[model samples]
Target: MLIERPEANAGTTGREREMKDIIIVGGGYVGLSVAVAVKKAAPHLEIELMEAAPEHVWQKDERASAIIAAAINMLKTLELWDDIKDDAQPINDMIVTDSKTGEPVKPVFLTFADRAATNEPFAYMIPNVSMVRALRQKADELGITIRHGAAVTAFENNGGHAKITLAGGEEIATRLVVACDGVRSRLRYMAGIKTVKFDYGQSGIVTTVAHERPHNGRAEEHFLPAGPFAILPLKGNRSSLVWTERTDDAKRLVESDDMVFEVELERRFGHHLGKLELAGGRRAFPLGLTLSRAFIAPRLALAGDAAHGIHPISGQGLNLGFKDVAALAETIVEADRMGLDIGAMDTLERYQSWRRFDTVRMGMTTDVLNRLFSNDIGPLRVARDFGLGVVDRMPGLKRYFIEEAAGRTMHDKPKLLAGEPL
Candidate 1:
């Protein structure tokens, strides 16, 4: 029912006469990873990526993400870890505290020191630019065609393949389509896949700060009345902060003068780290949870934030996307090896079922954590603090949490996540 334009075959051979094997939409870490992973494993597959932004846009991202141990294994398997390791700062220790914003002395409800037990840091904070750079380099090495400034204007599933129309009116025919676009994905909407979404009425203010004293790779999460204030260590004396506050308050603060902003920041970010200075620009992102009802539709599959967008309370948002990359990549590669239709309903279902439970579970977990902590109700505060203290005292329970956070306790993990290649 769909026709491929003559211009679409300009550079094609007999193998690419009608359609590309896979077309991944989005150019973020997750989208690029999917392209690299599948192309690396199955060199015969004709793959291309369509990015809506310009070629150099990703380099402008000033944000950083917390990468867990399991995701590190996948990056190593992709041979990207070496390029990123130098810029990555390990999370050697983490402590949790519950107190008011101006509390002089806050009691530590829980502390986790897991590097000794795991023989590796639980996670690392890696800049977005570094991760994207490595992935783009690898994608080029794999001969994956990445088209920038090409946004999807239309998408159609033609039973056997998919036809995607670009904003420039160019048409692409592909055996499969993978959408790794962000939470508000146009591809997901085009697929008619509904989502269960909830706005938290809060925004996370993200910025980098340079302090006089070193953090020693320690991270802290201070649960205050508004929401969680997280201090995640970066390289040197720099730390990235995810400060949650009411929506209106966050907007005013981000727009406020530097002096007023820093004053309020100092009130929450104690003096333990000595004087703090703004290391980079600040931005506020609205907090929300969005989970697609289905991960697959016809010959299309969704990955990354396109599939699930969870709150940052547990710092697992990007890590969750990495997990999707690992699972979905393995599924596609294995199906190709078996000479099965990689975009067939059965094939995509395997990936959907494999990822659905984990996605929903994480979404619910973050939701509960946000609701339970982002309040000043005295009774609730006392109960949650007691719970944290109890968990901290139980060594075995604490170990389980560390293992889970490091992604070591997951069952039936993909080969890439476990550091194995297809």
Candidate 2:
């Protein structure tokens, strides 16, 4: 638990408790981004962020996330893109294939060229650690207080303010609390917000691999009988892999010896990339769809996985969280400028209204895509493959799909997402 206070404001008596305008729980991508964005928009607001893990642990996260075009715009608006741009690997193209495991040949069904009219790639693959590091540095520059190793044990919404108790007995009062604590968020439960959840009976095995040959900025998604296996390009000849399998099979593969794991990996990963070697450790995450019934209650609001969790089949989970960050920050900043209570139910509802429908739409789309592709039913496979082939043949349709994947669809885009300042 976080037991130290900020050095500049240390040594305060019991009567001089520090009160903040906003306190964000969880210091992951969503949480940190929200904190930084809000502080950027409204510098006068006192913001504090709490994380359950130690400060050093965030830098150790080896996972990679796909940042869609809209999220890239949001980062640029936050003035953070320049710091991490060199570490991002743009996805230039994508190929989709369908085949059963151990099949001698996998047939390509569809392909997408990611370059839009502006000659920009639709998305980029960035390391989670790098993104968090940049956001933390920006937050420090803005004087947003961050308490690592701090977990909110409980919270109470007493009409206008939220009283939060930390695990180490520190009590904080804030006008609003944003929960970005993830899919199984404790704060969401404490706020009495229920969720609609469905387990997919599958697990995603994630790791990085270095290949002898370059990927040439290409991404590949091979739809095997179990699930989709994605090879996303990273810096150099390395690529991030998201391999899906039956939960039991996934656990077994991850727990297997290096040689056994490599053998299984090579079976799905074609030799086109040449010699393959594991570039990082492996981890398996259970697949599921979780959506909160309400995004706001009293002085609390949900963001990121705390609000919605969708399948990673479309690689939109992190992008969706970034959408939440943009919307919530815009809402709070606008409310503050209008001299209204940012934490009020009316103010928070606007944010909910802005994001909830889009969240559900993406969640359902991924759910349907996972079900459609992660099976071996003969007739369904034939029909879906035919559909993919048809989409592949139409240039205009493919471009439209690429734009949608780039998050260029018609919707109530927040200012930050549109690369505008609040």
Task: Give lDDT tens digits, candidate 2, residues 92-156.
Answer: 99999999987768898999965975689999999998899899899999999888889888988
**Model 2: residues with Cα > 4 Å off, grouped in runs:** 1-16
Please give the TM-score that candidate 2 achieves against the real structure. Answer: 0.96
lDDT of each: 0.91, 0.91
Supply the global lDDT for candidate 1: 0.91
Candidate 2 collision pairs: none
lDDT of 1 by residue, 1-422 (tens): 22233355654444334578899999999999999988988998899999999999888888899999999999999999999999999999999999999898989999997673559998999999999999999999999999999899889988767788888677777879999989999999999999999999999999999999999999999999999999999999999999999999999999999999999999999999999999999999999999999999998999999999988999999998999999999999888877777888898999999999999999999999999999999999999999999999999999889988988887789999899997
- Consecutive 10-residue window with the lowest summed lDDT within model 1: 1-10
